[model samples]
Target: MATGQDTLWEKFIQPLFGFLIDREALKELSDSIDWETESDRLKNPDLIYPEYYKSQNFHGIKGGYLNSSAAVTYDPITKHALPPNENWNREAVIKAVTGNPLKIIDLGCGTGSTTIMLKQAFPNAEVVGLDLSPQMLVMAEYKTQLERLNVQWLHGLAEATSFDDSEFDLVTASLLFHETPTAISQAVLKEGFRLLKPGGQVIILDGHQKTLRNTTWLTDIFEEPYIEEYAKGSVDAWLGKAGFTQVLTEDVWWTNQLSTGVKSISNL
Candidate 1:
């Protein structure tokens, strides 16, 4: 599915890792998985991918999340990318939760890393991790299987999910906004607002806008097409526009930020 276009990951990091790690072992590991069959089981055949998602290469991968290669390689690159530590970065999302949420959903949940953490933190909650990429969902399912975690991995769009309105007690998105266009990001926030029940909270973990704005190199280091725009915008303002109350945005580590908002209890 690669378009033969070189990305920063492909041009630099991948080659560096290949030099240091066992490429044959990695390839053998990739080949060992039944990618097609596994992915097909999680795929929503009726879902149509948007032009915004399909047109661009992500993380130097030609087909972006749609490709099996992206799912295979995401965790390795992510471990190096997240500052402090990947687990610490993701744990911030779990720590942001307020009350005991019975129903939770993670939008754009890549490979179920953070999603798994959510389940671990709130074991009694019903956790659902949804992503547009079936390949990514396959990896997520595999991970949950390993942990014996009761989590649902769905192939669906973040901006528009199939679930009923006001269903979830909590909604979370980690490192998802920067990869999407600003408008789409806004729409996703609105969708999160719609999905949450009255008095429910929505948590977003992504790049620190101010840090990214001040440091051009951070955005430049990755092949993220929309990060520059994401850095320029305000998630606080977006949450306000989406009809959320008690909104707050706080810095996490040096490069990331966590934004949270609650739906009004009076909505009922």
Candidate 2:
């Protein structure tokens, strides 16, 4: 994601929200974490960041997700950011889930919000949360620790994960596609297809494209680089292009939408 420093979000809104958060406690938490050790534990040494990701500023943050501040402020800002409600927006993903999957992966799982929810939804499932930012993964691990949920967090890319083919029963991403270029988002869907077992499913929860195209100011509130491009495309089209069957996309909470598709039983 990229944004101008002079944008409305950067000029006023982000600062206002920053003032509202408990900075003292956030600093304390940041100081407490052994960033080096934690990052080393979660990061994949062989992983390489793409130019689009490594070079851009996300959410008006200078270092994007790689910054520790992005991790610290993510949950609080996200709670109020989602329309109607944050948990409600995320729960739409859970509601869209089709089966009791034994293995699950949440791509671009920043701070493990929806990832944790997935674990709670299916306590027995082996859940994993993967992101490009090790800083975000540290916060994700901390959040899961507070929840007492055993979720595996990994530092990796959504479009090119290290996981084997036909390994997962479910693959999901929440509010992730809008942050990346359309080509990367499409590639991620294709990667999801490769990761799923024959007859498994992929679900995506993201902004309602129709709503976004109509409501420009909604996106203007934040410095979203690819949101406009993302809004112009269709998740259904992407899923179908990735060779998923039974594709469906439905509006959720007016602002968000859930799109789902299943791999063919004979896709092995």
Candidate 3:
């Protein structure tokens, strides 16, 4: 189902990023990073992530998120790749969240966009960004430091986190579900259910599903292997099955869909 553009990004753009990556600089980043502060960074745990996530050269980035340079360049590349949107970071969905959430966890938070935005909206809320890649966490952490934000980054898998049950008031994931396989997506939904306090909400912001999307060019342009399956799948049903209530989905800025739901009060 890949198009000519997909072939181009895979053949040219990906290799170009590899040439641009600085291996020497990346190797040195680990020396000063304090992995244990606030965030749980289990650097080399006995856990396993999906093979696609671990192996793919996502978004034509070299070494994927494993490369610190990829982390350094991911935001700029994606921003340029996306069409103009007034809700740049999908702030509308974030604003629509009803809870006066005091703690938030953003799963698969690449570069901490959703995580930081959540913290910016709720300054007093304890916010955490969790991702499987250390390099991505480094970029997220560096951004947090620059902004002097009280956001913490965790290096861990989204499907299975070390966080305790009902540890958060809200769980958010942006552009994550589409990249993951359906099984992994199911696991992440279950994990979201586990991580939320009773009545806590889960918000998933991702590529516009075919249900609401007019074009498939973005998927072709980016070579998203899982987009076809994701667009066809029902995250809303998954949420309900995971013991969520009042599940809803709405079209958001550009080609993104926002699915939000609450855990039942009875679960409390």
Among these predicted structures, which one has the highest lDDT? 2
lDDT of 3 by residue, 180-250 (tens): 88889988999999999988999988877764245655566577677787877888888888788989988
TM-score of candidate 3 against the unseen true structure: 0.83
Clashing pairs in 1: none
RMSD of each: 2.5, 1.6, 4.6
Tell me how candidate 2 scores on lDDT.
0.91
TM-score per model over all chains: 0.94, 0.95, 0.83
Local accuracy by lDDT, each model: 0.88, 0.91, 0.76
Error in Å for residue 14 of model 3: 8.2
Residue 16 shift from truth in candidate 2, angstroms: 3.2
**Once superposed on the true structure, which residue ranges of model 2 sit more than 4 Å away at CA?**
266-268
Cα lDDT tens digits, model 1, 1-268, are: 2224474556777787667566676578679889989888889999999998988878777788998888878887788778789999999998899999999999999999999999999999999999999999888887888899999999999999988999999999999999999999999999999999999999999999999899876665577778888989999999999999999999898799999999997654
- Over 132-157, each residue of candidate 2 has an lDDT whose tens digit, in order, gives 99999999999999989999998899
Please identify model 3 stretches exceeding 4 Å from their true place: 1-47, 211-214
Candidate 1, lDDT over the whole model? 0.88
Ranking by TM-score: 2, 1, 3
